[model samples]
Target: MTANPARRSETSRQAILTAAFDLVGEVGYAKLSIEGIAARAGVGKQTIYRWWPSKGAVLFDAFLALMGGGPGDDAALPDTGDLAADLKTVLSATVDELNDPRFDEPMRALNTEIVHDAELAAAYAERLDLPMRELKRKRLRAAKEAGQLAADLDLDLAIDLLWGPLLNRWMQRGGPLTHEYVNALVDTALNGMRQGAPG
Candidate 1:
């Protein structure tokens, strides 16, 4: 019987992504390399280059795979009708994820790569950032309809306002990422929007 090339390719791809994900965590991104990843995955370096343009790209895909995010995955935020509560819930979970030690090194590494690599940044924005933002917008849009937020709120700017501080704090290591902090951020952002909203 002939081996199935498609199945074999999928297996190799999975192995490579897993290896990249694990290696970045174990060794940190500064020390990660294509040769190291290939050896860890038990595949040729060519296989990785065949699929990804660089180590940063590989790491980005690996991060996405680990997070279960992709083109077709559900990225919805909680929309329980209470906009502030829902935002707090979602942002609190984000705080937990950002503070998780297992994800700390890898996330920092990915962020660093994104900052320096234009291609990887573009991929991250398209595949992860935009989708997540749209999902958030969907939740906020619902809240707007329910009179919880401004009807004319700029959803994109609102998303950024709610999330930007948290992200900046985490990336800058300015303070602890806690649920309380997330709640404050949610409250503050929502309050500002509501005040500007036409009653």
Candidate 2:
């Protein structure tokens, strides 16, 4: 009996992605290489190269795979009617993921690649950022329709105001990314936006 070619190829791809993700966490992205990932995955180097153009590309896909799904898959944030509580819940989960040791190094490496690689940046924006931002905006739009946010609030600006500080703080290590911290952010942003809403 012969193994299905498609199944075998999928297995190899999964192995390669898992190996890349684990190696980046253990060795850091600067020391990670296709050969090392191939060795760890027990696949040939040619197999990796055939699937991914560079180590960074492999790392990106590995990160995405570990995340379980890509954009458009789970497109909604939890909308529990109370916008503040919902944002706090989601952002708190983000803090946990960012602070996690297993995810920290690979996420940092992916951000670095997105910064320097134009093509990767475009792919990331198309596949990840845009979808996530749309989810945020969808929630915010719901709140606005409910008169919880400013009638004229620019959803994009609102998104930035809510998220930019946390992102900056995390990337700069300027402060602890605690649930309390994110709750505070959610409260502060929502308070201001609510105040700005027409009475």
Q: Which has the greatest lDDT? A: 2
What is candidate 1's CA lDDT for residue 126?
Answer: 94
Residue range 1-199, candidate 1, lDDT tens digits: 9999999999999999999888988998889999999999999999999999899999888888877756456557777777888888888988898888778888899888888899889999999888887788888888888787777789889989999999999999999899989888888788889835444
Cα misplacement distance, residue 129 of candidate 1 (Å): 1.0
List the lowest-lDDT window of 10 residues for candidate 1: 67-76
Clashing pairs in 2: none
**Each candidate: RMSD to true structure?**
2.0, 1.6
TM-score of 2: 0.95
> What ranges in model 1 sit over 4 Å off?
71-74, 195-199
lDDT of 1 at 97: 89
Report the C-alpha lDDT of model 2 over 107-136, residue by residue, as the tens digit: 999988899989888888887799889999
